[model samples]
Target: MQKIFLVLLFFIASSAVFAFQSIESDPIAALLRTKLELENPTEKLEVSGRVLESDVLVHRFYADRDFEEVWSRNGILLELAYEMRFEIRQAKFDGLVPEDYHLALIDAYFQTFEANKAAKKPNEAGELVALELLLTDAFFKLAEDLELGKVDPAKLNGDWEIARKTSRTSYLDLLNEAIAKGEVRQNLESLYPKFTIYKKGREVLRVMDERAKADTLDWKAVKLDKAIKVGESHAAIPVLRERLNYWGYAKSQSVLDPKLYDSTMFLGVKEFQLRNGMEPDGVIGKNTAIGLNASPALLMEKAAVNLERLRWLPDTVQNLELILVNIANYQLDYVDKLDTLFSARVIVGKLYHESPIFTAQMSYIVFSPYWNIPPSIARKEIIPAVRRNPSYLSQKNMDVVTFSGKQVDPASINWSAKSFPYMIRQKPGGSNSLGLVKFMFPNNHNVYIHDTPSRSLFSREDRALSHGCIRLENPALFAQTLLKADPSWTAEKIDQAMHQNKEQIVSLPRKIPVVLLYLTFWADSKGQAHFRQDIYDRDAEVLAALKQ
Candidate 1:
């Protein structure tokens, strides 16, 4: 009888201890249970008006926590709230606006709670659960923008097929994973671009912003009727010197004789011209004037726009052998592991025929290639030319060919037709439009990097003259570089093939990836910002989207 009484006493004492422990250690759990019914998570989310992209994810998220507080526990999640606040504030560095994510409201709510943690009423704390839901919603929205970009390039430009992350974890899952691993910063950083270029651009922005704060450059347009070249003095020299100093091109602003366009000033002007995508001839012409007139704020806006454009690129560019074309800059760079193996000035499509931005695998290099003139070009250009002169095709080394490889007499076909059912192919020769070699990357756009007979056009500062194809400055050099993998094709052999005066197809042993991109503003490895003309007027559209 005494043993049974002792066992009952011990059971009662154990139960009391367990209850006290639950009440003391988990006050938030006890309070939430009394204040809110978490089992009906659908209704809870409905009341908050927070709908996730995936309903299943929402249901699973709430089910995991039984609709309990995932973000906050005692008053508010002070540490996490502060972390989010910091990220929001740092959004500008990433070319993002914090106001877009309700940054002010989140920070205000967190601050109020942090200051008065003990003053939170039970009902008020329960009501603040909505803050938890709102924050989670905001966080996921932020992540999506940072990871996948806010604007869809495909929607803006029809030809842009930028690969995006289709599969991603739920916001709840991401939060839990971060918390479990105790790595908030790492998780947030993962959402941004993996490219080092993006980071370098941010650093440049930071430095430029600091400089702007110290003294905002108030550069006025310095117009001159005549061109200002080296070894010649001009009245605009003082203004030009001031402008160069503001742009960090000139060494000092405290010159006693700023009016003199000395050799030192000439060097600075040349460097400025080069960085601004103009010919570094130490000549202050119309193009150089435009660069000097662009204020620091305008330059920053350009950089920000290009940074957002960078976000549209793939997170992982696994293509080791890359042919990257910067259309805005009118340059092509063959890069491998952050090293530029080969670079050349390229003539891209004109404003009307803007080059389509995309990526593809180059399969082959054709030697002394025949130029198959596009149907649109033939209808718009060839037909008209033939009408004016019947000998146009023969003079230009062009011939009419049926779709099935049958040669058709140019005189036999009516030149007055609105469209031609046949293709016009240029015969392989020095007079042929496709010079000597062409890089073929099979794409629907029918755009190829090829040699051109108009080599003098490459000397122009602005080389946007092609219809839609990329015209390489040195095709033989490009061919030699690409065929280096094949032991059978030597540099001498490549040169011989190009000068063979007959069409010959040479397939690449291994495929090389090619990316045609547009970047009006970017930073070099040294964090120096480079600006280029928006030849196709693409920067304004992206800037408008960024503002939106």
Candidate 2:
């Protein structure tokens, strides 16, 4: 009975596609015209919430065609419907839940249509209309999610004001174009970022979900009272080996020296450490233990959340020179045409002063840049420090200036005043907060990538010690790379400009796009996934929103 039903669905589905290809007089338009003229418009669509507005779009679309069935005509689904169904089933490849796009409802309608055909009974006219309406709704819903991510950026984080503007293309017109070109799947797929990392994330999530269901994954914390060094003997060595093997870090079992931390186990632990955003020291420490203990499901959830964040990026990222800064990873990648030219370590903002996730165009580079103290820092730190020590400004290569650019004597100002409304500008020198050079991308955040005198911080595994700005380890090298398009700015010229004690601005020949994103989980080109600590704890909020 099951085999018969399956064969029946395939036969009807195939017939629908064949009929669509054979029709020359726009069968959908004729059916829609006949349905619209009927006294009863009984197929009231079942859509609510944000999607309710699509009803007007759907009605206008059919009315424009004189009430023709778009996806089907006379109870026969079209090739467009089959293509849409296939795309909907593969929505996970785009970091979307298939269920969210009404896949089950669509399958149910097709199954019912198949049963009616097999029984030699006509499906209710209202039911046929409902099928078309729901399928149309699914297309729009899927398109919306693909174009603009599931959550609004502004709602999630007010500082995330860098999302691309909504496309002005009418959903109905897009559907019509897709149907005409027989490219429903292509249309939907074109709306997302063309990065392979997203596909890897989906694949990882699938494996994680399977592991979760089988209960084969273990996240039990492995704690040793004493640190285990290479070639050291420990009671927990066997358990550590088991855990490492389960996570695919270790390939072979060592029974001869099972209780000893040998070279093989040491290398596996280092690789695991690297994947977890920790310094790969090969010594099992507290942080390594914590990383080993992270639940696979939790890591999978992070990957899923980050995949959605990728969807929030502007579509321009597909074909542009992109400077992507992964805040969680504390690394920046200079990419053009999907090829990563180089990567550098970076220092992001501290937890209390979180770095924002946004996109902007890098227009220019400022050499020997002055750091204008932010009002909050001036009020909280500079003023307090100056009050305690009268020579604080001169000692730190800083000067007091009025809002109107008039220089003021730091010693002359009243230190005990309640309000300090003056600007504290740091001089362009080695001790300046902005180091020797800064990459300027004008935005409301007042944040830019710059060099730092505190170069020692870059060596640390966790380099999140900034005042809401990124500090590049090699700012001069980055500046030279950015000016590669300009023949005037040679490597020697860039170095000379950086060493100068005077401020100078050099605009780029073409603006480079920069994206500051906080992705806790990232997959490299080779499909090796890495998970970072949610320094800002954004994963939980994003996961909660996805649930809603």
Candidate 3:
């Protein structure tokens, strides 16, 4: 009996030792314990008191729990944190770790996830994944801060000298290495917290990816000696063939004939230019080459930055039939039931006179809307025009009115007087500055979309030409589309009202939502983000806000 008892005791001790070893060996389990240790005493892991009672937070928790149930076998909060840490470590390898900006970054990610959930449609799983990646990046950044000996419980709010001291060259080298290895692309949101140019880089990367997939010709294997001459241009046939392939024009077994270079290759270049939203001409210009040779990593970064911009948008895209103006793209899209019904190129407010981002409803469409000359315009444009050409107001049918509805003659009003309390109204006419039609969505900014007599400006790629209002390319067609939503109205009715050149306000039968957004990057139907220029320099402002 004593011998049996000793053997049983030994077996029990061995089993206990094995179990302890296994727990210590498991990386995930170890990570969970470590995170719990860090968070539990710090109280940072607790849900914010302010948020806990809010509708937004409640909805978010439910959505996150649902997502966890679906993807992680109902993983506990600690499990989620551990997975986040792993993701952060992965992001750190790509130089995208979000050091020193932990709480704010995490909050941003959660807020975005919550907003996406509250949107009441199919959750953008892509956006949710991006947020998770962002959280991971934050963890790695925090880890990096600790490694650099910059982690201070009290000094967390202040500037970290270590991050500031890091050389730009080293940072860029690390990023480039990661890009080359395809460890991370520019469009990954993890990079946005670190780099300002990430947004621009993403746009370039997307274009590069599209160009690569489209182009089938391999230039690297071609011999430079086998050059062919066509028309007035003389160059390597293989190089030309590769360029064609890169632009998605070249097919397998397709050999470029020397004589067809001017016709085929030149035409192909034009098509490429057109597709990229550039000026189309049958020429392999410097701009075209630069655009074509742009790296994919750079473009991806731009997309990532743009995705950050999307977070600034309201959680719920209110109003069914709405007009959305993408400022960076200099374009307006009319969406009904979340479907794009009409689109037009628009000349938005210039950088100095930037159109503010807000949402409103199109209550009325004015046929021959009166152009109320703003105070700034009155002080600068009208006063200068009168000084140069006194009949300028008359030629444009603009009448100067006193505050009491009394008409003041433009010739009589003192040009030098600073105390002029006068309102300028451009009369309804063909030459009216507001043009034939104006889509009105009254907001604090006092801005709206309208037609312009200056059609020549629409041809330019950079259409930030307006003072504050949006100038649409095809206003008549746009009006027709909007009006057609009501069965009683026809395109003929809209045309008649415009041709009459009378000021007629047509209230929308159903109010259409207008979202004047400032998104620089957004994914299209293909899940590819289309990037636009940061025309208003809003990226830095947004980035600053995010950092805070």
Candidate 4:
């Protein structure tokens, strides 16, 4: 009896699978069934030499329509095809490849369809059906890629949390609704990121593209052996002025000598340095020369890669009052309502120990926080220093503690042992690793923003000097900004708490989101293009995947 029931269930499922592909009195439906059932469906479904990328979506789309032609009625293509084809061609402006959506094949088929209509010939076998399937698949692909990003950031270990713009609408239903209302273009446009940065980047790319097409990209190069200080004379000064002018920075030609770095040129050079993430000193140094010599092609490539990164972010990042730290820029910004409330320099992790890109919420602030040295650091750095200096622990105000965190005598342990089992924690004081306060947003990586005793590191232009944590330049001011809503936690009270020499936790009234990103290229609100070196060397990998 059991065997008979199992056989009945299997037959029911088999009949359900075959229900959609049954050939009725329709040539388009029959052709679609034949092509989709071929042994190699990918090769069989090829439309004018372009194999379909979304075969599964095509199957579902047609099955829902009972395999009827979507782009045509009575073997004549509809006006929606024209609008969709135009959108496919314009996909290039969104940092996407137009040809990836079968643009060339669609063009070929479209021209032949028009020619056939003019000559009074009938639609060719499977021609309209192919267009129907391709159009639907293209629409779905664009919607998904724009809404959820084309690249899988998780595959690259990028902790990107992308949320859909229309969480309540299904893609299939959205596509159907769009076609029914003739709102195809509006539907596609709504999926792109709504950030102002994204819009500015698109405009920048448009200008760059037009320049490339016209072959009119004005760029210049500079070569110098040593730093050219203000009022110095060098043959490359004229080239430097031209380079600055190319990016909207104008420096008047020196009346005395065109090669002279005059006062006017010095200010322009300082502006260039500031824009390119360098110290704004009026010196034509090596790094500034690299920036001056950057070609249009390099900027375009970096812009494309950073645009892809922007697609991976959640749109709400711009909608909230948040703390944003761009690792590549070595800076932190406290922003609300799309305006930066405060900005400060930051020290991030070194190249060997890269600061990860992730998001968490700041829930509390710890005044006079103890520095819990990580196990890796203890094994690699502290133990070696202790081995070299007998009183290293005492000098640094650190203690040898058990896993449970009870203090132990440092001198009682064997200094030369390779397999040490202990944790090193610094006491809360002026010389503590964490200076006076630490903002908490507890994550598995043990990373947080805090004040550091090594305050001099903040003055350096390249502040990637921490051990997988972010060190703030002004923690006191940051605290004041965060606790401004509560009048009790004034600047003086916050200061006294920092120097109390006791660990005290202050819970925030509400959790504010903090996002750490690594965008190497972006445009400021004033339309100035800012560029930074790929400090962690992540551009090549992301760009390769993006183009692929």
Q: Report the number of clashing residue pairs per model.
A: 0, 3, 23, 0
lDDT of 2 by residue, 297-387 (tens): 7777778788888878767777678899999999999999878887899999998888898888999899988889999999899989988
Q: How many backbone clashes does candidate 1 have?
A: 0
- Model 1 ranges with Cα > 4 A deviation: 1-63, 68-72, 114-127, 157-159, 163-171, 219-226, 231-239, 253-262, 316-319
Candidate 3 Cα misplacement greater than 4 A, ranges: 1-262, 283-290, 537-548
On residues 31-71, what C-alpha lDDT tens digit does candidate 4 reach at each position? Answer: 88776666375353565556676677777776787777667
Q: Largest lDDT belongs to which candidate?
A: 4
Cα lDDT listed for each candidate: 0.76, 0.79, 0.57, 0.82
How far out, in Å, is residue 390 in model 4?
Answer: 1.8
User: Model 3 over residues 1-548: C-alpha lDDT tens digits?
Assistant: 99999999999999879755754664333333333334444233423221111222222332332322211221212344444434444332222323433445555655554575477443343434333434433433333332222222223332111112221123223333443453433223332323233334434444555665665544343333332333434444446546666546554345455524555566666666665555675555544554455444444444444544443333345335678887777889997765778998998988788876667778889997778888888887888888789888888788889878788877788888877778988888778887898999887778899998999998886788888799998898998888786876677787788866458999887888787766665545444434456677655543443334
Better of 1 and 2 by TM-score: 1
Evaluate model 2: give its lDDT: 0.79
* Model 4 regions more than 4 Å off: 1-30, 37-44, 72-77, 111-125, 157-169, 216-224, 235-238, 251-258, 315-318, 337-339, 524-528
- Ranked by lDDT from best down, the candidates are 4, 2, 1, 3
Q: What lDDT does candidate 4 reach at residue 36?
A: 68
Deviation (Å) of 486 in candidate 4: 2.4
Candidate 1, residue 113: the lDDT equals 69
| The best candidate in terms of TM-score | 4
